[model samples]
Target: MKILHRTEIEKILSSLDPIPKIEEGFVQYSKGLATVPPVGELLMEKGEVHIKYGCIRADEYYVVKVASGFYQNDALGLPSSNGLMLLFSQQTGQLACALLDEGFLTDIRTAIAGAIAAKHLAPANITAIGIVGTGIQARLQALYLKKVTTCRQLIVWGRSAEKTGDYQQDMQREGFEVSIADSIDELAQSANFIVTTTPSTTPLINVSQVRQGTHITAVGSDTPEKQELASDILARANLVVADSISQCQQRGEIYQALKAGSIQGEKVVELGNVIAAGQGRADEQQITIADLTGVAVQDIKIAEAVYLASEKK
Candidate 1:
């Protein structure tokens, strides 16, 4: 079996545009053309690990990914995210390649998925983008959004003032007009298109703070214990979309909202269905929220793409 390291995987990703593939993966998944089992998770005192595996029915290979986050790793000068993906031949049941991406692929697929969410769900006239969190995902979400929206103005809010300042400087260097919001309320008021990328267990954005015509993509709550948006926000949203309805029933903002008796299960729609049916926000005045818990089909598609690209080289 071939083994590709993080550097090689990064190089491969640099040459690839994964948005289309990820979009197709979601469509296939929602159509029942993919096999993705429930996520396996291990929660620790300072970190968490997730094991996701699945295969697209039409694809030649299946993928297994293990990704973890140690919240306190930064003090040791190490990236908190780390993991790898394994691709196996479906026909022979043999491992075909090992992608030692160290969670880079996971991050890329997620960011691309966020862009997909924006492409289908965001408003046409996006004045500014609001980013909640100052981590890697906050940066990637904004960068990937450029693929779907032309809006380069950003207002960011984070718990740490220093981190928000750093995020502003970093985004400004990338040609975006960045501003730091002192609170989530300020960020919500300034930008209609918001992306929340934090692992906070408590709600950050409340329904009262959200305005009409706002689209919020919550990506940090892959686990049941993590939540970033108020349950009332989902209850108040005109449209609520999930990357996977089944997955969201057990995790993410949807689960929290459902548990709180704020939103009904029938009100939730899968992201893939919305994409396939070409259905999104009915009007610019509607408020939309997409609860993204991350899906294994994403790993299957991205891993297969990287493996195929390596052969071409």
Candidate 2:
């Protein structure tokens, strides 16, 4: 079997002749062949770790993903999560490829989702994008957004000023107009498209802080105990979508909202239904939210992308 590193995966994804529809790709995955254990957890010696795993098949190809996460404030150095992918031959059930799960596919797939959401949700006149984290997800979300929209200004925020400086330099090197914000409130007030990428236990952005018609993609919270926005935001949102409503209610940002009775059960819509039914934002002034906790089909879709890229090489 061939091994594809992070650089190779990124290169192939960037040079694609045509990109797949991320939201459609994810929705199909949700309804197709995907699996996850309802945000369950296991006890580790240091603390606790959450596991979410699954595989999906379409167009005669299949992809499998296994991801695990851990959060420890005291560690302060090691990454909180690790994942890997396995690609198999559909015709023969043979293992064809293996990926280090360096989060290359995961990051890109997520950024693709953000891009898709922006197209269907954000106002057409949105000029500034705000990112609330300086990590891998933040950078990828910013980079992918540039590909699918006209966002000219990018503002970033993080708890660490030094990390923010590093992110500023990195984005500037790519020719993106980048700035740093010390406060989440400042970033929320000015940005039309806001992406929250940090894994915070409490809500970082308040409902009043978000500008009218602003589109928010809450990306960081993939499990219980991880939250990125206040409960009230759900109350005011005109449109709220989820990668998976059942999954989101158990662990993602929407789950916290549901627990607080902020978002009613009837208000949540599936991303798949949105694409299939063309149920998008009703007006430009509508405040919309897309909560992505991820699904198994994305692994399958991205795995197909990886296999095709490998063949081309």
Best by lDDT: 1
Model 2: lDDT of residue 113: 79
Worst 10 residues of 1 by lDDT: 180-189
lDDT of 1 by residue, 149-244 (tens): 999999999989988889999999998999988888899998999999998999998889999999999999987899999999999899999999
How many pairs of residues in model 2 come into backbone collision? 0
Residue 1 displacement (Å), model 1? 1.6
Model 2 misplaced regions, further than 4 Å? 17-21, 30-43, 46-57, 69-81, 89-92
Q: Model 1 off-target regions past 4 Å?
A: 44-46
> Candidate 2, residues 1-313: lDDT per residue as tens digits?
7888877776877777223545556666556545444544677766554444445444555566756555563388867666778877777878888877566677777877778777677887776799998988989888888877876688899988899999999998877888888787888777888999988899989998987888899999887889998978988999898888788878877898899998887899887777767677787788899998877566667777777778877
